[model samples]
Target: MSERPHMSSTSWRRSQPITSGFGAGWVLVIFGVLAFLLPPGGTAQQPPDPVPPVGVAPAAVEAENDQELQTIFRSEISFVRVDAIVTDEDGNALVDLTADDFEIFEDDIPQKIESFKLVKHTGVFDPDLPPPGTIRNEFDLEREAAREDSRIFVFFLDEYHVRDYNAMRMMQPLVDFVETQLAPTDLVGIMYPLTPLFDVTLTRNHEQIVHALRQFKGRKYEYDVLNGYEAAYAHYPTTDVEKIRNDVSLSALKALAMKLGGLREGRKSIIVLSEGYTDYVPPQLRDESAGGGGRRGAMRYNPLAGNSRMEESTRLFQDMGMRANLVYTADIANRNNTSFYMVDPRGLAVWEYDMSQVPIDHETDQSMLRILQDTLYVLADESDGRAIVNRNDIGPGLAQIVADQSSYYLLGYTSSEAPTDGEFHEIKVEVNRPDVRIRARKGYYALTEDNATRLMAPPKPEPPSAVSRALAKLAEPTRSRLVRTWVGASRGDNGKTRLTFVWEPIASGQSRRDESASQVMLMAMSDNAAYFRGEVPSRPGGTLPLAEFEADPGELELNVAIEDEYGDVLDRAVDELVVPDFTGTDVALSTPTVLRAQNTMEMRRIAADPDALPTAGRYFRRTDQLLLRGEAYAPGASPVDVTARLLNREGASMMPLPVELSAGGAYELSVQLSPFPRGDYLVEVSAASGDGVATTLVAFRIQG
Candidate 1:
């Protein structure tokens, strides 16, 4: 193993000194020493020991026959896997060591190593092998991520804890790291504090990652609401808002770790770009409201104001709560074999607060700076990872991160104690080679008896057929196409089917924007004859390009040519659709049309207009209401009963939706979205006439 000379911290200091009151060089020197002391491979100083676990209460044992059956269901041996990185004094990985050169222990008892292998990955694919495929869905992501040669990395950009200027300075380094340091096979993802874990997908498209990073803007002390989530708490006190931010970030971190754990048991990395976290805001900067201007008059600068007994107690409690949350987050990361590489974007930061923005004494500023940096250190150290702090040049630290994940040893063994008490067990790894440091997970928590039993339980039952079909509708359309289209069939005159074709241009952000879709040349043909052939010009706003024609009920083939503004075709597609037979004697319902409105007035207008255009979009904001319109028909004027109900993604009924008969004779179902959370839901509409019954489902997504 060879070490990169750029990994040295000695030359990371800035040439010029900070103009802040404190001596910036002195603070940098302290942090630099701290960084070198850990040396990336191992932590010389361990965090405070966690509290001992309490013993589980005794429980009655099962019958001998049942115990034997359970034993057959569960694994006879409890295996523990540990990933260790052995590096020499110069921080170069030692890959030559074998199982004979290493020893392992659990809870101070020596255990025999049952499995050992060197897992080395350069993040570069072999030229001899074909290039990997793009990750388009969850299946692709999971398959690619499971490859041993592919390294998974996630960038958790905590914008709430970083200043805008600092974030700008750090963006180039991040982009460079992704563009130059990473190979084409590496899987990378970028996430914000509020981004849902399901929304994150790791891909090899480095350009997309770079584009997202370029748009990064931090908001450390600023409290303007940018989205619906922030709007909920944007008016709170500054201190409370800070606490909320801290909670949100920590929770996101834990969730990411868990998500990676589910993906694979191999080592994964989450690089957190943040200044640091603090639950308590300094007195000088705290305002009555987060978005309000500074308090009236010159701010009081009392460095010792928080030193009183009451204030000190309050600070102590807040610190305790923050520490507890950090411990929980670290524990989750470790359990998932995920490492957190903390990077303070405010490289060589000298002051916690900008004097120009807020009036603060030097002492308070210095103290707050230390507290924030301490948090970064605690998180990194607890997770057996390194913290890059107080360094002007972060390129070396970033390189070291790649080096750490490039090569390592994976070892597994069955625990000698085989305890199922649901307690944390300490692990120790040692290498016989001289001058080599071994860094591995400190330990892992054992599963309780009940947990073990549940793990061995039978697989879950499959979802209902109706639920499965509804959820399947949530699958996204292929984004490589030029436009998104919708087709519907309803009852037509003279015992024929009325086929409606609607199309809209896909957003430029979602697809290639080289050419805008102007119109669609549509040709609908049945087995016997051509029903329609014409051009549908695109319209703006709520109205879209729509074409309707009467066709015989059967398989209809559609050839659509998407054209540009100049009438030149940009793309073409062929679709085979089954036109429903609404002219039959059985009870039947027409394909539902979804119309979105911002308020009741808009909804009423849509209901009144029989020919109002239906939206092709399936995504709606929480404030938007959807009106579903369709026609229910029965033979010989026999009255047809129509009803509607809301179902969750899993197919369970959430609530009953009333179906109203409009004066125009159209059955309409109005859905208010504000009461629902952000997710995919289904609206099931059914029509019944005597023994004949027909049903249809409409699925849509709610966005925050």
Candidate 2:
């Protein structure tokens, strides 16, 4: 019932370095509405639909066409999954490996090989997956009862800083790092945000990684502020620099991370790919003018935002038992030397404060670039993580990053570093050979994440209920979307009138965009009641275009109350609407008897978008229905062939209407109607579209 993505033409870029501090919320609280545990496996025995968590069932499992739910008792064992990349020491991605070739360790203590499986190649989620009877007891119902012991992710995209050419230069290293340097089972995703096409997607498959990389179009498309992606920035006036740049896209990064945190066995990791002071966000909207004044008129750095963002990025990582590693990227061409081959970390700088403009021109550039090379040493100098600074060795450099992402051993020890009840602890990790580099996260914020993850994770209660889900799915009434409302006046059969409103589909709440998924559920309510209902086949969620929304538009009634994902009723629409039933054999007429209203039957042509309504538009096409009720009725009240006239308010002829009223039925028909000019119009229903039914009279205005 749904469709796919509307691939737009935007590219990704490194965002301007915003310097404020804002943290992410908690993991558990954030994932409150998501599925806590995986569904059950199928058995020959059917069980009472596994009682939904907290009594809540899905709104309605969109029509299931391929599942076999017969006598099988679906086992409800939650499935745990994660993704990673693997590579050998020679900087080559290691493929064709089995689980037997690897070892598992949590907190440094090796654990048993519980489960292993390569991720699927396809990107879509299949309702009929893992097949039935697949869970052979890999789940621990008791352990899950406590909390999800899984991992979370940090999706870092370089949108503003990296230029196109420079970006292309880093692509190979980036991919190599993700595929060869990361672990074979670590979950991670990539996003190159300057372009909208640089969307975020998870890749458990190396093939997917490669495929996505190929789809990367080098040429940038033209963009205007009028289209998508502008509403957020246009309204949020973050004009100051003291704030972080996370809210610009309403990015689900934080939300997505929280959702993934519920996974059964993943680790916590933030894969950062930006080149900055790591997290050196200056406080306040800095006035680059005054050595330290806050941001200028329109652009100021966030005093607390930058540091806060870093704190959030870090704390979020810790809560999920993860650490962050920056695959610090720079132009290979701009490197101190285009060796195009081997290199050493000692030759570079660890933390480069680009003190370039002050004097030492050539000296500064060389020193800064070298400082970048050394930046990794300082990071890896003591911690398990190594910063790949101004890196020249694409193959080995990325291979190292991928290893860290996928298989680098995760070892946690009881920290001797106590809180100052608040104190930063210096963490340290090492491999047997000092000759080879062992990269890992520099430090951890310990319990600082408690507040972070908690704030983000909303409170979890019971699951949803069937009645609730059904109502949630029900699309009812005539919802008027500011941008998609199609309203006009026209006449019907019985010298009566009609108001046809064809609005684009509106869901109960904010709809999540699923690329390429066609089906969507639209719902509406009467401003008069508390229930929600859907019009049409109530198949609001479908793949048809907007033109498909109104086959024969009808309205259903429901409660006026509006609710959100949390089931919390927020507010209600202001005015109540009473709609006529188009289905019943008879309709109550709203016009007076012997109505001499002039009418015209006009055709409404959808010019721009047939399946959509604009928030604002000139009503350019409207068919008017002219009405005149002087046809003498025969004895015994026989049905009359109502001759309706579709005329302009000036009584001028417009279109010839073709409509009818059934025997013994009342109607609102059209004698003749044609599209009206961009303005107000009156509709007069005929005695029928042609026959016995009485006509209706309705009036409405259309905006240009």
Candidate 3:
């Protein structure tokens, strides 16, 4: 692909927060995803495979649960939405179809049409929404995206396959299409094969998107050096490098289709600009040591005398790879209701190779061209889209894509057989009216047995009422939280509770100019009276001296004001707290504080120190260990032993971790970092004394 330009702005910082709305104790976890499955009528069932053993780590099981949850959620909606564009003999959209005029089926089983609606746009933007050119942030973009009438478009520029000359020629047509063919309310995004799906946001700023297209440059075969990823394999042979490039582009495209599918159950258009895909490189260009010049160097002397045996062997290998990639790509797009309109920019070309570089036979050149072009046709035809190939004027084809998006009939129905065997189910849509054609998705995937069971299972027991309320408060959304704050509680003097508040900035490459979270102003009060007020840290990016205050046992209200370097309040929040007196109880334990350490030596230092501060951030890397300590008290200085264990998000036990006594007689637990994978886990610690037990759960996420 062409190298991405360094466009400096807050665009990178405008990433949406990852939120998972599970129950109170469950947190959203991200990890490696499974491979994309092919759609129906394209591939046969492999056979009934045995259920995999459940002995894998919790991370794998959690991933399975997440996938199953998504599947079940889709199925439980009880409605399959199909977008159909009916065109008459003249190639104009026929959008006046009623619900009774459509028939839906799954695996040849007819289903009842529950709902139907006609979606039409007259090339006019909505009056209530903001203008197309006024987008400033991601929030503004999302507001426009939520509109039901808005159209979505993603321009996938496949520079890896396009020649530099072809890229330049195609830019004008694309820009013209955007400027003249699309409506102002349409939300468009620009993406490359290497662009992460999270970073691609739909926006109304058409001018900026067009400006980015003007700098398009293709890096087809001249891979010298551009980025770090490409540099790592620059010395590899050209044949191997070509195969890797194909896989990278296809994977990113599959992810993009899935992202669009999840946005809504409507039709989405992705315009792919490229030459085509080829598994086999011509023998004249294949070199074992590509940059070193082995066979290719000899080909310079006698280009027509290439080895047939070696060429045939390499061709077979490439065909297998290409077929597998094609299945996955088509399956993902069909299942997600996204169409891929492929544009081949090598227009009116006569030869695949330069005559001066490689003097190849005419038969070989024709064969190679046929195989490459076939890949493009298969992608477009299988996804219910048209392939604009073998033509010089792409204006008409580009305009047709927008027209298809403008008017369509949306038909929804409940599937008769709700299968949960994790297999592909075919879908067919037909119109009762005559002399008209129809286009729609071919199939959808069903959930697995395990996922369906969990989705139908009863809800887990709820947490204590007080703990439940506190956890619910964490679900509220915060706008660009530059800093994360935490409050700690322990025993204090004079039969009162000790409160310690800490705040730290979040480091995610999303900082603004001249803005830093200096300190926070803290205030504590009751319903009718105030307890204490103070300021922390006194400077930006500096740690505050741990201030401890005593408060009587009751419901205490906390009002916190977060300030910047100029002592200006950036955000303010109010919190409710319940304090308990430890002196009057027979056995008590403070809220366990977790302190993170990067290495074993740091862990030891933190465990031995009497005043190590707890980290406010909940995110931790796997390369870091953790030291958790808390004070357990008993009447008359009797002994109070504490034990700790790890639990999954479902509140089931995973393993028991060792708890030991630190230097100051504080109960400490050593959490090993290597055994855990990337997911949310809870550390349950319980204190045991004479006829008393107190337990607390500390939740945190480990970066994969």
Candidate 4:
């Protein structure tokens, strides 16, 4: 085993930072449900439409004839995929162009287009088939999203820049776009400025997406603190706070763009509904006091603004910061092949700020409005998207988004440079025909050396050792957990092994089960001989039972049946356990048990009481804390030092945790789930003595 990472003074385990193709300050958790982990030697399955059949037809009819085909490039470090949408001068899609009519260039050098296909999506599906919204699990969602005819659209509702009135007014237009323009097979999801990209999922359920939009309310200019991020800087002046909001929203947009890019190398659209952003807030509107006192103050003018020169200097300084942020965001969008359709919800606005509160001159207001509109234009133009500003009616622009996705071309080329320097490479696509317009991604970020190797490596073979295979099996149970259980095997009377099983009903919110687990019927068998059988609990969310059974030392096969109170079986599982004789081993460690506490009071009681048994459940919430207890023994009563470390779902080590000695030859460790994201993890405990070392692993999951 490798040396353990230094333990922190805090009880909780420290998080391990993950770097990827995305730019700096982006933390990608290793155990995310959607982590892009491909098998060794196996390439990822691209979307079906990217390799449509070679034929020319009207854009409307080509989508239906898209055949499932793929052009496999030679094993290389990277497969560059670009999505391009060509149109005539009148903004009509040009779908009749062939591969010969287009050219691709990388860093001013023309590159061979290894594969070309005119991809089109009508979002049509069989009426009898269920929509993607019916995806109950992650597998179903991925399957539905990979379909050739499915269109992915994410609504990045930037409430930070949108006012309350504008948010309500724009809600109808967005709803109309989803209900009228989007096909049944289209996958649409809504995200906010603060929404975690890991939690964002594009689904085909249009009704649910629309329902969520109906409740949308913008928080612009509202200083009343809501989340922890806001509370941290609530005391800052309104102007400074607004700058922070812009930083957060822009950072999130860049992160969202990279996330969509990782899903598939197809065209993706993010509808940005906002009133645009500005670096300068008029001095009169900058509230130094909390709760926005300047908005309602009798004296609206800033007393600190003694001269016009000072005001101009401050605005200039702020505008520079805003420009830098906008450039960073545009780079991410271009690299990720995602387009941002900026829809100014304010429509044809005359002023950027309200006169009643801002008290700024009309001339200054007009200039600020123009600056804000230009910011929106730059974002759309750089990402090959359109900015719908200075228009009261945004319905047409919103509809144009659907038309753009209805027909497009997907081009795949292998980069001749293959640079592992981790720098951005520029790409340019052009059409040979005259009087035609072209729009495609500007470029992409090159993969690092480590990332390139991982992508090109083939799938690894399964480990031959039994322990390695058994540890791998632990992650499988997480896929379907009607009842979360914890099993512990220790010494028993008469040379028999003592097996303890504790179980509780997993909350329905955690799983998609309609039937509630009321009782667990357990049957224990050693080879062909029956040992113990009984029902552990009689009700859900009630006190659990620590059911123990004695069995002869050997392999024990246990069958568990999860049933409702009426005896209807909801789920079943067969677990094989090897009961070891502790007395014969020179050094041994008992199976570590976990005890969960909902609050500080419960945690204290669990720690103080030696008789307190570990919870036989594995799933826990973020608000909960945990206490792990186990015992180690060695020959001649030699002392044993125990250590514990956290592991990700793939069995990769994350960080080490502090293990303290408890009374009666036992070891205890405390864990706080608040620092970790919701996912599957393992706690590996090892006991070292003079003669040898003993180890055990326990798997658990944290819920939000």
lDDT (Cα, tens digit) per residue for candidate 4, span 1-704: 32111100001111221111221112333322122222111255544444434674557344443322122322333557677889999998999998899899999988888788888876687565564456654455557766667888999988888888889998998899889999987888889989876567787779999998999998887778888888888888776788888888998887777666655556778999877787687765656754554443333564344237876777677677777677668766755567899999998898877743545677667767887888898788877788999888999999889888889998877777766666778889999999988888777666677865655554576432423433333332332466666677666788776777877766776565577788889998976689989888753335566578888877777778878879987777766666667666456777777788999999998899876767655667999999998777666667788888987767778899899976445888988888899987778888888758777777677867
TM-score between model 2 and native? 0.35
Q: Name the TM-score of candidate 3.
A: 0.73
Q: Which model scores highest in TM-score?
A: 3
List the global CA lDDT of all models: 0.76, 0.32, 0.69, 0.72
**TM-score between candidate 4 and the true structure:** 0.69
Off by over 4 Å in 2: 1-29, 32-156, 174-188, 193-199, 204-208, 214-261, 264-271, 277-384, 405-443, 446-704
TM-scores of the models, in the given order? 0.71, 0.35, 0.73, 0.69
Better of 3 and 4 by TM-score: 3
Model 4 lDDT, full chain set: 0.72
- By lDDT, who's the top model here? 1
Give model 1's TM-score versus the native structure.
0.71
* True lDDT of residue 622, candidate 2: 38
Candidate with more favorable, higher TM-score: 1 or 3? 3
Clashes of 2: 203
Q: Model 3 residue 697 lDDT?
A: 69
Candidate 2 minimal-lDDT segment of 10 residues:
1-10
**Candidate 1 local lDDT, 1-704, one digit each (tens):** 11011000011111222111222223333433322211111122223434334563223222443455555434332567788999999988998989999899999899899789898887678666656877876667767878877888899999999899999999999999999899887889999999966677898889999999999999988888899889988778788889899999998898777667656767889999999887866665566778775452223365555445665466567777877778668767876678899999989999987855655656656767887898898788777788999998999998888888888898887777777787878999998878888889888667677766665565577766756655554444444456667787788889898877888887876664467889999998977999999999888764777998999877778887888999998877777766778777877777788889988899889878878888777888899999998888778778778888998877778999999975323698899999999998988888787887777778788977
Give residue 660's error in model 2 in angstroms.
Answer: 38
**Each model's Cα RMSD:** 14.2, 19.8, 10.4, 11.2
